[model samples]
Target: MKSLNSDAFRMSIAWSRIFPHGRKEKGVSQAGVQFYHDLIDELLRNGIIPFVTVFHWDTPQALEDEYGGFLSERIVKDFREYAEFVFEEYGGKVKNWVTLNEPWVFAHAGYDVGKKAPGRCSSYVDKECPDGRSGYEAYLVSHNLLNAHAEAYEALKKCEKCIGSKVGIAHSPAWFEPHDFKDAADGASVDRALDFMMGWHLETTMKGDYPAIMKEIVGPRLPQFTQKQKEKLKNSADFVGINYYSSVFSNHVEKPDPSKPMFKQDSLITWEGKNVDDISIGSQPVTAALPVYARGFRKLLKHIKDKYNNPEIMIMENGYGEHFGNKDSVAVGTADHNRKYYLQRHLLAMHEAICIDKVNVTGYFVWSLLDNFEWQNGYKHRFGLYYIDFNDNLKRHEKESGKYYKEFLSQGVRPSAIKRDEL
Candidate 1:
C-alpha cells in the first residue's frame, strides 16, 4: 500500500488535557494549544488539510460539578468563551471547525438513562424538560446546543476572512425500520423511533427547532423556545456532518411512564419467532452489536439532501470493526473484512449523492484513525481500520482493511497525503 492523502483530516483536542477540571479560571493550557498548532502543521506539511473540533464531549470535570454541565444553560456562555479563544488564536492555521460532536449522543449517553459522562438527570419529570437529556430532555439540550452552536457560527462567520471556512456539528443518525411490516402499530412505532434518534437532532439543526411531533405527543413536557431563539436556531450550521452506523426497528408502545423507567428501543430483530417491538420505552436491550443495515446509509443521505435543502454534508464518522475473537481475518490483529467493505460501500453511496442526487457533500472522515479508549465499551469494540494492540504493548499494525484503505487512496482517487507506510 502506498500514497494516502486527503484535503482534510480531523483530530480532537481532549478538554481535560487543557482545563483538566473544565474551568475557565484554570487557564487555557498553552501546551494543548501548541499540540494542535504542531498537528495542523504536520498535516499541512504532508499536503493534508486540518479539520479541528473544539469540543468532543470531554467536558472539563469542573463544568460538570458546577451545575450538571449541559444540563444547565450555564454551559452556553462557557462553551462559547472556550470556542472563541480557539478561533482567535488558531484561525490562521485551521479552516474547518466543528462546534459540538453529536450533541444528541452526548446528551442521551451522558444523561437521562446515563451511560456516558457526568451521568444522570435523576429526576423523572425534569427528564421530560427541554434541558433534560435521555429521551425526554432532547429539546432543552438541543435548543441550547443550537444556540451555542449558532453563537459560535456567528462568531466564526464574522471572522470568515480569517478562518476561511464554515463551522458545523457532527450528529450520528441511527436508521430505523418498522418492526411489524404488515401491522399499522409497527409503522407508528417507526415514527417514535425516528423521534427518539434521528428526528430529534434533524428538527433542531435543519428545521431550526425540535420536531412538532414532540409537542403534539409530549404536550407540555416539551421545552419552550422564544420567537427570536427559533430564528437563531434555524440555519445555524454551515454544513452537516452525519455519522451513519446501523439501523433499527420501531414499534409503538404505551406512553413512557414517569415512574417505571424502561428503555424500550425499536429493533429490526426478533425473539422466539416474534418480531421485536418496533419501539420500547426506557431500558431496552441492544440485541445485536449494530444493526447491519447498509441501505439506510443511502436513504439518510437522500433524506438529508431533500429535507435539509442539501446543506453541505460530510460523513464525518462512519467505520466498522469487530470485537469477538477474529471473524474472517486473523493476522494477529483486528480490522474485519466487513469493516473494509462497509467503508468502501458507504464511500460509494457518498459518491452517488454527489454525482446523481446533486448533494453538496463535502468530505468524509472515518470514525477513528485507530482503536482507542471507546468510552464505556472501553476498547471492547474496535472501530479502527488500523488495529490497535493496546495489550501490554500499544503497537499499531496496519491490518488488511488499512491496507485496502491505503490502496483506495493510492489510486490517486482521494485527497493527497504522505502515506505513513510510504513515509
Candidate 2:
C-alpha cells in the first residue's frame, strides 16, 4: 500500500486463527490477537488507514462440525461473540470495520450453488452436493448473517474505544440492466433482480425489513426478523460498502414453478450476460463477470442514492478477472493491457457517480493487490494489479496496471483525465 501511494488497505482475519475452536470458551490465542495489532501498527506507520473486515466467509470448521454454520440460529450468538472480540481488541487502532464481506455471495454461493466452503445445495442444483435445502438454507444463512452484522454494529457503537468507528457490511451487488430498454416487463425484472440480490440485505438494513417484492415472491421461504431484530437492523451501518464487478441484463420470466424450489428462481428474473440481440453490454466479451460496463456502475450508484436514502458508500471491491489458465510468462502478465483498461473505465464511472450524480462515495479499492487464490476459480482467474509467480516461490511483480494506479494515486489524476489510448 505504501509503495502504491495508497491511503487505506482492507483485509480480513481468519476466525479460527483468533479462537482456535471458534468460541472464546475454547480459549483465545494471544499470538493470533497480537498478529493483527502488529499488522495494523505497520499499516498506520506507513501512513495508511486500515479497513478491517470482521468476517470474510472463513467460518470455523469446528463451528460447522458442531452445527451447520450460518444455517442455524445458534451461529448468530457465536458470530456476535467473535465480532465483539475483534471490535474490543482493535477498536482503538482500526476506525473502519466491515462486519462481513458479501453476505449474499457467502449465502448463495456457499449454500445455494454449493461452490464455496461448507458447500451445500439441493441435489437438483448440484448433484454432488452432500446435503442442503437449496431455497431454504440460503435464506436462513442470510438471515443469520444479517443479525450477526446488526449485533456487531451495535457492539461497535457501544464500545467507547470504537465509538467513532465507521462500521458496515461489504455487499457484493451486480448492476442488472433490462434486456430491452423499451420492454416494460424486462424493466420490471431489473428491479426484481436488484431486490433479490442487493435489496435482500440492503433493504433490511436500511428499512428495518426486507423488500416488499421479496416478501411477495419468496413468501414463506424468506425468514422474518423479529420486531427487536428489525430495530437492530435499521440504520445498522454508518456507511455502506459496495463491491461491484459487472453488469448483467435481466429478462422477466413469464412463469416460475414454485413446486421445485431454489433461492435464485424466487426472483422470477433471468440474469443474462447478453441482451435480446445477443450483443455484449460492455467493451469486452462476457466471462466470469460481464465485460467492463462503466455506465452500469453509474446507474447502480444513482439507484442506491435514490432508493436507499444514500447514507455513505465506498466501492469496496472492483476489478477485472482474466483466466490466463496455465500461461505463465512474466512478459505476458506484466503487460496486462486489458486489466489496465478495466481499472480506468470503472474508476472513471465511479468518479462520475461521485462528481456528477452527487453520490456520497468516500473511497474506492481495487479488488486486490496480488493474484491470489480465488474461491472455486482458485488461481485460474487473476484479478490482481500485481502478478504472482505461483510456481516460482510466489514472487510478486507489478503489472502495468499497478504502475498506472501508483501514478493515479500520487498525482490525484481522475481516470477520465487520461486518454485510454495513451496507456
Best candidate (score: lDDT):
2
Model 2 vs. true fold: TM: 0.96
List lDDT for all candidates, in order: 0.65, 0.85
Write model 2 residue lDDT over 1-423, tens digit each, in one string: 321235999999889989989999999999999999999999999888999999998898889889877878998899889988998899999998889899899999898989997778988888999988888889999999999988888888888888779988899988888898889999888878888899899889888999999899888989899999999999898888899888888888888876667777888877787899888777664333347787888899999998888679888888888775556567777888788878788777777787889898887889889998999978878888899988789989999989998888887877669564532
Give the winner by TM-score. Answer: 2
The local lDDT score (0 to 100) that residue 94 gets in candidate 1 is 78
Error of 2 at 215 (Å): 0.7
Tens digit of per-residue lDDT, candidate 1, span 1-423:
111135568777676766666655777787877887788888889888777787888777788788767667887887777777778777887777788888878766665556666555544534533333344554456666777787777777777454567777888876656666788877766556565565666667666777766656555645777787677767777778787877655555654455533223221212112245434311112322464555567667877777667677877788764566444233645536666656566666666667777877767777767877788778777777787676547777787778777777666543223222210
